[model samples]
Target chain A: MAADKDNGDQEMSGLLKSNFGRRDFLRTSAAAGAVALAAPARIGFAQGGPTINMQTWSAAVDTVQSHVNAFTEATGIPVNYGNAPWAQYRESMVTKFVGGAPLDMMWVSDAWLPEWAEAGWISPVDEFDFLMAYNAEAEDFCTNSMTYNGRQYGLTYYTDFMAFLYDESKIKEAGFDAPPATWEEVVEQSLVMKEKGISDYPMMLAMAQESWLIEFMSALVFSHGGRFVDDDGMAVMQEKDKGAVEALQWVVDAVNTHGIVSPACVETGELSGLKAFASGNHAFAMVAKYRLRMLNDPEQSQIAGNVKQAMMPKGPNGDHNTVGWMRFHGMASQAAQDKARAESTAKLIEWFGGKANGAYTFQKFLFLDIGAGFGVKPLFDDPEIRAAYDAYGNVDMIQAQQALAMKKDVVTPWFGEWNETNGSAWQSAILGNTDAATAVMKSAEFWDELKQDY
Target chain B: MRRLFGYEERSAAIFLAPVLAVLMGVAVFPILYSFYLSFFRIKLTRPNRTPFVGLDNYLDLFTNDLFWVSVARTVTFSVVSVAAILAISLLVSLLLNQNFRGRRVLSTILLVPWAIPYVANALMWKWIYDSGYGALNGILYQLDFIDKYMVWLGDQDKTIFLIANAFVWKEVPLATILLLVSLKAIPSDLYQAARVDGAGVWQRFIHVTLPAMKPGFMLVLIYETMMAIRHFDLFFILTEGGPGNASHVLSWHIYVETFRNLSFGSGAAMSYVLALVTFALSYTFIRSLGRKV
Candidate 1:
């Protein structure tokens, strides 16, 4: 009886699945239209006058709100500004885009440019000569990052690059007059620091598979003269001479052989790594250069006076290269369709990303409020911005490294798909589950497959 | 109105229309549409290019190595989590079943873990598992269990289990409540009869209590199995399917495919596969442990 009942149940489930027809599907699709009402209630629509709906990740909230208030007073164009937590921001924006929410403008990452552009979710800004004028004064890579295909998509919000940082006190205590200049020197110094009992893990890396993983990996790859994808968008990370293997192998040896890098590095994310580095526990780290502001602030860091930036170490065939990334103010494609809305959003984008009242007001203030790097070349000579950087950072080294910084080669429409696989493959190599070559090869293969799909 | 159809039926149809419409709109439609979408290549980014692909999505998943690995990880996580929750809940419920001082207070205290939000619980555990100054390290260090602080969640071998520990902590309270109700519903005469038959504490528990907790066990098992199989938030918060894909379970795979890769078709197919497995397990538990239909 029990056997008969189980068989009957299985049959029922099978029958249910098999019985679904095209008519039922059509009926369901029609019924599902009601779910559109369940979507989060949108803000007021701009019927009387143009209102720019802006979405940003919650960072510098007070600063952004004050700026929005000022813009409204100055332009008389009301703005609906909403923000989500930084970690979940992209997911939320993707949902809004897919659901046809009333989005006028949003912050777009360089990594998302290709995908967003291809999807028609965002519109290009090539026609806006007012916005385009800033491109000449902007850093070349920053402008390039904002452009997808042959058209410019937006104006730069901010740009920053990875920097190699070390605790100067620990380095001095370990009897090093200068920081390492190359990958080999890093391993040597790390081993010496480990043997001296100065630190347990002399080199700290946030290799945990998260959003920041690609940035960290890219910096290493670029400095080592390797590209995950070449200028022509073909995978070359698997090539032995391309410097990917050399960089990855060095890390593997540091963890398993030299014991300089903690095995737990695989699980450590950038946030945790920052805290650990600030706790005066490590001699070397690779982090965002903007973090220098926090590191040198006595209130936030234990090693406040000791933290210092260094040139990114070179590989055998590479130079002191690093990865640069930027976020920009973008117009929604739907909004851009309305010429009046387009003009208003373009003006708003210019207000924040370029200048306000004929001066780099937003850029100047943003740099002062947060140590976020600006793309405008003129702001580099600003007294307020200069003083802030000189307080905590070396302007010369920042400029030199920024010059060397390259946009990530792997940013394509298929980037999001390829990233997880690449991160995992690199991690597997670090864990000794696969050889470095095999991992690199597998990543390249996956990249090729994704590239094919696109 | 009675002449239109029948006296009672006409009135009933009129009254139920609103509720039935709502049910069709919200619940039935989504499931059917998702099923429909699973048969097509619906890339959300290229919203215009969704074409019918028949069984291609399912075939692709079945052949993919990552999908297989995710399946193994999902099975491992669900089995471990459900077993741990069941064992802990049973023990707690049995102890609570006894007449003891502050029983009510203890029961209320047991619900605290369950009361915490999923995001908050994951964040709390994240801090606890920090290799630097986390509570786990602090306590372990204080006890001289280890000479130095050791990585907890970051460690690949321990990532899934550590996540499971957090999951079990929250889940045990609800399971305990269910089992406690079963213990309460038992007649006092059952215990008296067992005593009359010279059954000792252990024997009576074996023959009477354990056997009687079947319905509760079925409920707990089915519920937890489904929860564990589809659990995403903790993995998302903790490892993010990281440390060399050590904790990349099926649910995370589905999310990455749908949300990250924008491959709604394959993601929907994977979700259906997970649903089928969950349903099969629930059915087996009900058949073995539930009261006869």
Candidate 2:
């Protein structure tokens, strides 16, 4: 009986071992099949190229998406585009960059370029072959705006400068056949327009706590033969030669003494001045050249077809200098750390902004579609582009003149801090809460502190 | 060695391991990291250079006038907005608790402001407060409230109040819902007993209803105060701490320090100060409530 039991146990153990071995073999085969199925797809993706990721604010979402789609179609490399609202864009970008997220390229404003490049947050593009294809005008502009410590970090995408957009009908009603030639003439014409009842608020100035005020003040100071920063790159607002105080005084007088500007100007944001001018409630507004399209659009502007652009009125110093704003596409240093990805991103930027394809570039399309001015000279001189802008009456010339009048070598790494401090000081002065001289002095002090911290 | 905990305790801990890990990653780690960062001088722009600054960031902030101004503004905003929210919420909850026509519909409708996205709500209020073409100016002019349109956001105090009102409009809904739930939880027999003792409407409310809703009131007070003190989006969109830093609060100041100034160390220090103040206030309220209860 014991021998019979031992034989049965041996049989059971052999059967169990055989079944386990068979199951293990089946499982191993299934795993190998799964790997075989997925390996080709993964390898294909790897060989295809690294996907490019770009970030910007909502303002550039449409332009970026369209250009990214075209680039992807031309090259099988996929691109990921992300955007946040303008208010959150700076913080979001900084967080993503500092968090070691995968950001390849981004649209940075001219004001932020200095700080970003100085801190080595962006990769220098001077060595890229595609950079050599930029036209002299575009290259000079980009180099002036994007160069930090003599190394280029960006490619110019779009350019906008502050200019005077006036109501032609109102100016004519006020007995002025031409735009004001000087600041004095501006005040005189504004008073005339007010007396004629053509506009309740003859001057629409955006004095809100935004960069608009800083841009306007910079233009004013530059036109007055003053600079925001000295040769040493220190804020020179308190310097007597820098007309910051006088320029700010003019802004305050426009609101308080002249009564030509609205008391609510302190609440006006970037677009509010343009809207106020477009609504036919103001005879003149100092705004960016980008407002040309909106001013000419019949749906958006009540004064459509009756508005015209001109260079900013000259200051007492007899200079026509204005504040130039440019937007650029910059490569992230982290993205450029990988040579292949860096090459791809450089190609994408060249396809977007370079003259390699001439009029076929994304920059040209952007200018034609939205009336945005290209940083490239040839595009600006193109007959089709000129005609497209001429439809808006001398817009092309006005933008060119504004570009020529841009203050040279004024931007500093502390541009953001300078803007905020000066904006608040000017806003307070405009609201009659503080004197212009005192405000400028206070802002200078704040700038000094900012410099110390940096 | 003998086991410190039995199998049941070990099993419970094993079951909670995932949640504990998540909390450590999200909450505990950030708090610890921020505290560590507060002792160093760091700038997001200058990522490669971070030097230990010890308590300089905190000392500098305490000496900074702008920091103090923001703290004062935040305190005032919290006090006024929380008071107004509590009053409006209590009244709404009392009204909703009573049987009325369309009570359910009204309760649901009250939540619309709170349901709307904060950005959208802020934009709406910005339009309403617009001086030139805003609905507020238009309606007030039509109603003959003023001879001319007033710039509501231009004045510093008016801007703060307008923001506070918008905040109350959004916050009162949740407060009302919580208080209403608390009101409902009170037995009807207690009200009957109060009525049998000849308690009038006001007396019944003070005697029985108030005592029952004390916990709910304390919760609303604590939550709303914290929310009001950290106000950022509305002020950012509406006034941007503007008309000369009149509407600036502690959170916006921290944002300026961290993002705009790129001074992460200073921002971290300010955050700790804000956290400490909030914790102190919350503890005080809870402790006082505990004594009362």
Candidate 3:
């Protein structure tokens, strides 16, 4: 009976296979249909199309989408567009990389390239045409931003620098003509503001999360002539570099001794940082250029015209430093599942980055539409763009100050991961959970742990 | 007729096959694969290069102090949290079993914390523990219960306590659910018989309820212990295992090794070690109960 049953089952299986069309034709057809949907993408790219994904909430969203339409009409390459929430963008990209999902191109923060490249998560561009097309003014692009493993990883998408944002009216109310130019002067003027009770919170630092902390403190450390991390992957802080420790101590003193920053500042993250500054609760914040937009927005900000941007205070080392940071949008090398798609995507990237598309994208879409107002090299000198920015004379002066002074922090080969690892520890120190020395030591420990794995 | 020990041959095979296959597929295969991976240098970072390294990762991890420290931390957190969950859940289940008004409502309320997403729960608790504008400090200050703001989540030394508190709050409800189900399963006749024999509430609980709920208790213990080991989201959200690694647990350490450090070999090795440790703890629990499925 068992032998007969086994023979019967085998015969039935063979019969079923024979009845199925053309050796799994249905499955093949389904896959082919999906590919057919993707065929138009090739057609678009062949005509010099560029597809882009941007953060949904960013000011640049509408601008980028419209510019994509224009670029497609001009170049005949269809632009594919997608959007991501700012909060989830970083984690979403990581998921795509891990899952090998179909994301041919995307945007990433400048700091992410090193770790991404090290993990072989992105493709290196060596083509001269692509480079020339992507960033024609390559030298003007922040040198430290794009260089990874001594190779150009991507083109600079936009530029932004942090400046000291103060209430110009508040300063004037405190009988000052302008913002303070030195830490001592800030303390003195803040004390004056405190006595007059004009500003409840004289100064505020976004000491909550490490991302802002690193940006704010790097500028401080660099002004004092300290290297954050050395080439061998050792944190220079471990060596008790005079500049780093001094800068850290100054921050600690600013919190504990001066009592200028709110105690709650320790628990505040980036959004909260922006909120505190915009609410007129704080007199000064080391903030990026885009904050002015929020301050000017009537729906979101309470203190509009009162806000003014100023150069960051000069350190005792007789030097002032600033850090300009921004996100970079590009195509992912790992995005291509096969050769044809990869070729088409690469060509699209080249086209989008080239002069005909690049200038339009930056001018019409990114800067104007997004209200990002970030200046790219080619469009930096555009009269209208300059006029829009120069309308606020104080902000214009601060932008000029930053351009002359700030350096993009070295994107260390492993710096992206370092940010993830040590960024929080830096916050802890400022929050009074740990002292400056222990904080640096703990940061060093994290660095060392990462180094071993590297 | 061939004297087959009277077992229903077809029924027996059908019952065993599913469980046997599941045990092999989900449990056995992964364990074996992890063990194999532990011996080699597999990089989660560089997925393309999975070259084998004989015991180098293991040796490196063994020598690494951070790994050992995290292991110690994980063990401590697991033991403390598991024991607290068991004790609290048992007590709560006993209270709920009493005939009382609003018992069901209270039980439903207990389920709310478990229903909450881990990230949301973390944020809620983070606010409660916030130093400056948090509910705890705010109320304390308003009521003049304390003089100066105390940073509950801010202190490194106190972070483990905060994390444990969150874990206990979340897991006790689940443990209570299991224990309550087990309690309900015990026959009322057993308790009535114990009462007739002049048994008190404590005595009945000791003799009848405890013995009857052994399987359920063991299951809850095993599940909670595994969860305590594997769960990194809450810690990642609340502490980022920081204030200088004071709160860094094994899972978080493994995450840093794999994702942040991008050392696939070391990350794989650490993760395998973590899995092994979790397995050993679970196996010990199962063996001590004198049970297998």
Q: Best-fitting candidate, measured by lDDT?
A: 1
Ranking by DockQ: 2, 1, 3
Q: What is the lDDT of residue B106 in candidate 2?
A: 97
Q: Candidate 1: which stretches are off by over 4 Å?
A: A1-51, A68-80, A338-340, B1-12, B291-293
Q: Classify candidate 3 by CAPRI docking class.
A: incorrect
TM-score of chain A of 3: 0.80
Ranking 1 against 2 by TM-score, winner: 1
C-alpha RMSD for every candidate: 12.8, 6.4, 7.9
Encode model 2's per-residue lDDT on B158-222: one tens digit a residue: 87888999899889999999999999999999999999999999999899999999989999999
Taking the candidates in order, what DockQ does each have? 0.44, 0.55, 0.23
Give a tens-digit lDDT track for model 1, residues A147-175.
88889999989899999999998888889
Q: How many backbone clashes does candidate 3 have?
A: 6
TM-scores for all candidates: the values are 0.90, 0.87, 0.78
* Higher-scoring candidate on lDDT, 2 or 3: 2
lDDT by residue for model 2 (A1-454), tens: 9999999999989876877587787998899999999885575355447788888788646777887887778776778888889777877887887888888888887777777776767888888966755746573554577667777777878876787778888888888889887888889999988888787779888878875666777777876777756767676776675647777777788888988888798888878878878888898888888787789889999999988877777778647767776788889988789998888888777767675345547677777767676676666667787787787769556755656555334466666766776777777787777898888889888777777866
Report i-RMS for every model: 1.6, 1.5, 3.8
Candidate 2 regions with alpha-carbon error over 4 angstroms: A1-89, A99-106, A127-135, A139-142, A334-348, A358-360, A407-410, B1-4, B97-105, B181-213
